[model samples]
Target chain A: MLKVHNLSVNYRGTEALNSVSLAIHAGELVGLIGPNGAGKSTLLKALLGLVAMHAGQVLFEERPLVHQRQRVAYVPQRSQIDWDYPVTAWNVVMMARTVRTGWLRSPNPRSRQAVEAAMQRLGVWDLRDRQIGELSGGQQQRVFLARAIAQDADLFFFDEPFNAIDKTTEAVILDLLAELKAHDKTVLVCSHEWGQALNRYDRLLLLNQRLVADGDPQQVMTLDNIQRAYGENLQPSERPAEMPFFC
Target chain B: MLDWLLEPLGYQFMRNALAVGLLVGVLCPIVGSYLIVQRMALLGDVIAHAVLPGLAIANFLRFNILLGSFVSGIFSTVLIAWIRTQTRVKVDAAMALTFSSFFSLGVLLLRVLGSRLDLMAILFGDILSVSRADVGRSLWVTLLLLLLVKLFYKELLFYTFDPAAAEAAGLPVHTIYYGMMAAITMTIIVGMQTVGVVLVIALLVGPATTAYLLVKQLHRMMLLGALLGVISSLGGMYISYYLDVPSGPAIALTSFAFFMLALLFSPRQGILTRRRPLRKP
Candidate 1:
């Protein structure tokens, strides 16, 4: 389980996240939904300790998350990665085992096995030798997902995994999340998905510079909560054709 | 061919220059591969120029110039990072500012001190005039760099490819970053002996980029780049010896010629001989 207490993040003197707090139990798949600049990605980065937090702390099972980063895995947005980087798909997945393999040493047999199994599970084993830039967009997404899986961490954080990916990759990610839940792992996915896709998560946290709502998907998708997070300009009930928010 | 190659070895200066050139050739591409991958090729130029101030100060203070060159090089990168992070100024602007100021300071210090160091030789290397001490220093750097790079290959690879993920995995990304900067600084100092500060960036970036056009892995790029760098350095030294040209410019031009060849004929990403498209794997 992960616990965040009064977390605040500031960017250039402006508060990006203010007094935000939330918790997720093990075996749960939680979707963090918010509009642009709503601190969704900032929340993930804060939890992973990738950025300096203005206030408060994040705890995973009683210890500070920053100290226990070895037990966590993060898949950053695809846009954050450079596809033109001269690395094979296999090399990208092997990177997940770098820290665990220890310094001044090559990956041991067990580490190599984990990388191989993860790549195979994600159906990218066939493209192992191919350059990452040569792969399709969906294949690139799958490669990153495989990297996260190869880490074998107890907690996983995904930033915008659904953005610009094909439906097949989406289905594969949902299936993998289900598998993680079955294994009693925790997952926090930062997503921009709406409507039926939101149903895939066990719970949803609507955020707009703060935690506006948190509960079951149907309960959190109320017009009042949507308007509070996405602004009053979107009238979901009156504009059913335009609104893809209702679960 | 054997007679011509053997004729240069009879001279002591040629022997020392050849040793220094080959050592630097192998060293530059290894460190340069990281810079090219991180898209910090310009940083190499910044560090090379910044070394001038260090060299001037070291001469004035009566110390080893290499130590001063290294400290100044690392300091320049730190200052650039600090400016970019603390202010809205972009990295390119920070680099340009740091490079010019340090170079100007070096020039002024050299003139004020009136040291025995030759500005012309420092600006445009005279490889044929190198002493045995220079060869020893170049050899020491080459060994140290090769050892460090071999020991930290995986950590550097992960950090260069995706720093955020490396940090999330508790890989000490910041330490790795500074370590890379140190390695690059050491390389520029060694390379300056053969190609001088102005042309060192060519040795650092050209061969690595040329290798990048033909290879898909970081290590392969380094291996191939080293081979190409050796060819360029040796070829340039021979040309300079035969044609009465400057060693620095000759080496730079040779490296550029190799790069042009790869740009046109690379199988994967060449303008003229593309065997496979970049997409549609």
Candidate 2:
């Protein structure tokens, strides 16, 4: 379980998030939807303690989030990473164990087995030896998913994991998320593709600088909320073409 | 060939110069890899040039060059890191501000100390004139720095690849970063004596950058970088000997030449100088 109370963030005197609060119970998959720069990524960063919170606290399992970092895993936007790094897919997945193993010790055999299983689950086991730079965008997203899986954490925060990914890869990732829910794990995903998120997530949190609405996908994802959050940004023809597939 | 090359090896000064080159060539790339990965290639050049005033002051004080360079390099690193962190000044502006200001101060110091100290010796190294004590000190520092890098190799890679993730994972990313800066400071300090400030950037960036163009793995890049460095050093030393040229420039040119070769000929990502023919344009 995770709780964020009265959270606000400011960057260079510009307020990114203004007194927003939300919570997710265990086993729930919450989709955080918003326009660009609407504090979606900032919320994730604040939860991960990567950003300085102007006010309020983040709690994981009733403790401060920073102290419970190991129990939470994050898959940042693939576009945000330097893909040219010399690390391999295996190395990226193994990085999940870094918090548990610490710097002085290497991952144990069991941890290695977990990493392998996670890679296999995500259909990236064969690509383990390949340099991360060589992978496609979908493959890169899968690698990050494998890393989160290998972390074996109770809660996962993914920032736009499905962006630029094909439909099949998106389905595979959704199925994996369903499996995580079955295992009573928590997932908070930030997605711009409302249709895909609606099909998979248990709850939808529509946001625009503040909590616009939070409820079931049907209740929260109304055209009014979408128009308000998006603000004439969506032309009728520009509405996601993939909504029918999800329906 | 062995007779001529072996003959020079018999001289103490020749041995010292060779040792100094070997140590510098090995150490520069180890630190330079991090610099390149972090997209901070020019930071080395900035730091090397920025430490000139400290070197000049140390020369005026008749202190050891390493001690002065270390202090000055640390000061510059702290200043640059602080400026980048505290103010909105971008990295390049901060580097330019710090490097130019300190370098000018060094010029001023050298002007005042011109009568007693040989500024050219510090600007452009006299590798052939390296004392045995200097060579010993270089060897000791290189060994210590390499050992530290080896011990913390994983942490360094993690920090370089993703600082935010590493910090969230509870690794001391800042500490590792500053520690690396310290290592770089030590490396540049020892390097200043043999390569001088002007040529130190060549050793710091050339071989490592060349290796980066050639390899995809960190460990392999490091090994290839060291190999490239040694080859450049040996080739430059020999070419300087035969052509009666300045050894420092020869070494830097040789390294630059290798970089060009790697840039042109590397298999994976080398610049394709010859464009593919357009199909039925």
Candidate 3:
């Protein structure tokens, strides 16, 4: 379980996240939804301690989350990755074992097996030898998904895993999330998706500089919540194309 | 052919220069591969130029010049990182500002102190004048850095590829970054003697980039880059011995020639000689 208390982040003196607090239970698939510049990615980065927080504390099971980083896995956005980097799919996935294997030593047989199994599970085993840039966009997404799977962490954070991905990758990601939930793992996904696809998550937290709504998908997807999170000036057409919003 | 190759070994200075050159060739590209991957090639140039002030100060105080330059070289990278992080200034502007400031300070110190250090020699290296001690230092440093690199290859690879993920996985990303900067700074210090500050970037970035075009993996790029570096170093020494050119420019030019060759003719990614779809069967 994860608990965030009064987290606030300021970027260049502008409030990016303001006093947002939420708790996620084990085996729950939570989707963090927000409009552009609503700090969805900023919130994830803050929780992962990748970004400095202005004022807040995040605890996993009563201890500070930063100290328990080993039990956490994060998949950053595709824009954050340099696909042209000279690494094979296998090499990218093997990064998961780097911290676990410790320093000054190569991956042991057990680590290697885990990497292989993770890649195979994501249907990227056959493409392991290919340079990551040479793989298609869908394949590239799968490679990172495999990397997250390989981490074998108790909790996982994915940033916009569905953005710009193909149907196959989306399916793979949904299945992985389901598998994690079934295994009692905690997962948080940042997404812009709305409509029936939003139902995939057990819970949704709509955010706009603060926590606007937090509950089951149906409870969080109300028009008032959408308008409050998106903005009062938002046109009907400005809503996510898949979800119709009637004023 | 044997006599032509053997003739350069007759002189002690040539032997020393060639020894230093070979060592530099083996070392620069290996360490420079990280810079290429991280897109921080200019940082190598910054450190190279930044060492001059340290050399001037050390020479003025009658200390070991190498120690002085190494300290300043590493310091320059830290300053650059600080400026980029604490403010809105971008890395390139920060590097340029730090590089020229440190270099200008070095020139001022050298002038005011009236030290015996040769500015021309530092600007454009005189490899043929190296003593046996230079060769020994180069040899030891190369081996030591190579060992360290081998020990931390996995961590370095992960950090270079994705610092955020590496950090989230509990690796000390800042320490890893500083360690990399230290390695690159050390490499520049050692290679500075063979090819002076001005041409050292050519040595650092040239062969690694050449290997990059031909290889898909970081290790392979380093291995092949080291091979190309050695060839360029030795070839430049020979050309300098025969054609009477400056060793630094000769070596840098030789490295550039190899890069051009790879650029044009690499089998996988070359502009020319890439197999067309018709030829792929």
Candidate 4:
């Protein structure tokens, strides 16, 4: 389990996140759904200690997140990566093993096996030789997913993994999430898809620069919570009927 | 043809110039490969120009200009990092700010000191007139850089490609970053004599970019770029010799020509041949 206490993030005199606290337990697939500029990505960065926007500590299983970095895999948004970078799918996946292998040392046979196994699990083994830029959007997502798996992290954080992806990628990610949950891996997925996709998450944390709602999907998707998170943007009638957002 | 080429070796100055040019040829593309991959080509230029003040001060103090250049290079990098952290200004604005101010100070110092041999050496990269000591220094720099690259290639690759993930993996990312900055500064200072500050960026960025269009990996790009760099330097030196032109501009132009050729003719990524997908029918 991971516990974040009184986390706050400020950027250039503006509050991006404020006093947000949450717990992510193992074997749980938590979906972080939020409106634009609601600190969804910032939350991920703060959790990983990649940014200094927050002052609180993030602990996993009673240990600081910093100590668990190797056990934590973060797949950033598609836009955050450079597709044009000169690397192959194999190379990207192999990077997961970089920290496992020491500096100036090549990957051992065991690490290579892990990388190949990760790529094979994601069905990207055949595209190993192709330049990452040449892969389709769905294939690109799979490559990153393979990298996270190759890292063999117990806690997985994916930022907008579904963006610009096809059905195959969505299926691959959903199956992987299910597999990870079965394996007792903690997963947090950030997404904007809220229609039918809202039902997929075991828990939903609706956010708007702060935690607006946190609980089972059916409990957190209330109209009042939606109004709080999307303020003045979603009237009662504007809410999608199938969403079951009770007034 | 061999005799014709050997004629240039007849003169010790020409031999020295050729040796220095060849060393820089191999060095620029190797370092430039990193800059191009990180999309820091502009940063390379900024650092290149930022060395001017150090060169001027060293000339004024009659101390080692190389030391002055290296110190100024580090100072500008620190200032840029400070501005980025302390204010809302990003790396681009900070670089623009530091590079302009440092270059102006160098220009002012040159004016105050009056244009002299040392000033000309930094400004125009008087490669042909390099002393024997310059050749030895360049050789040492080349050897040191190659050794470091060999030792830390994996770490540098991880850092440049995905800095956040590299840090998440706990690789002392900042120390590696600072080490890289120091290496880049050293490269520019050593190269300042071959192409001058104004056109040195071409040597740093051009060959690597050219290799990028043909290679699928960073290491390969570095290898191919270093080859292109050596070829350009040698070719430019010969052009300068036979055509009676300035060696610095000739080398820069030669490197640019290599890039243009790659742009137009690269097998996989050339503009001229986008590799028409084969039809299933």
Clashing pairs in 2: none
**Per-residue lDDT tens digits of candidate 3, residues A49-152?**
98899998999989999998989989999888888788999999999999899988889999899999999999999999998999988899899988988888
Error of 4 at B18 (Å): 1.4
Compared with the true structure, model 3 gives a TM-score of: 0.96
Candidates 1 onward: DockQ, in order: 0.82, 0.53, 0.82, 0.66
Residue-level lDDT tens digits of model 3 in B10-47: 99999999998989999999999999998999999999
Scored against the true structure, residue A243 in model 2 reaches a CA lDDT of 34
True contacts kept of each: 0.84, 0.41, 0.84, 0.68
* lDDT for residue B169 in candidate 2, whole number 0-100: 71
lDDT of 4: 0.86
CA lDDT for candidate 2: 0.83
The TM-scores of all predictions, comma-separated, are 0.96, 0.92, 0.96, 0.95
lDDT of 4 by residue, B1-281 (tens): 99888999999888888888888889888988888888888877888888888877787789887898889888888898889988989889898998899889888887887646465556657767776888899999999998999898878887888887788777888798778888889888778887788777888998899999899998899999999989988888888889987777888899888888888888887888668789999
- In candidate 1, the residue pairs with backbone N, CA or C atoms under 3 Å apart (3 or more residues apart, or in different chains) clash, namely none
Candidate 1's DockQ is 0.82
The docking category that best describes candidate 2 is medium
Q: Which has the better lDDT: candidate 2, or candidate 3? A: 3
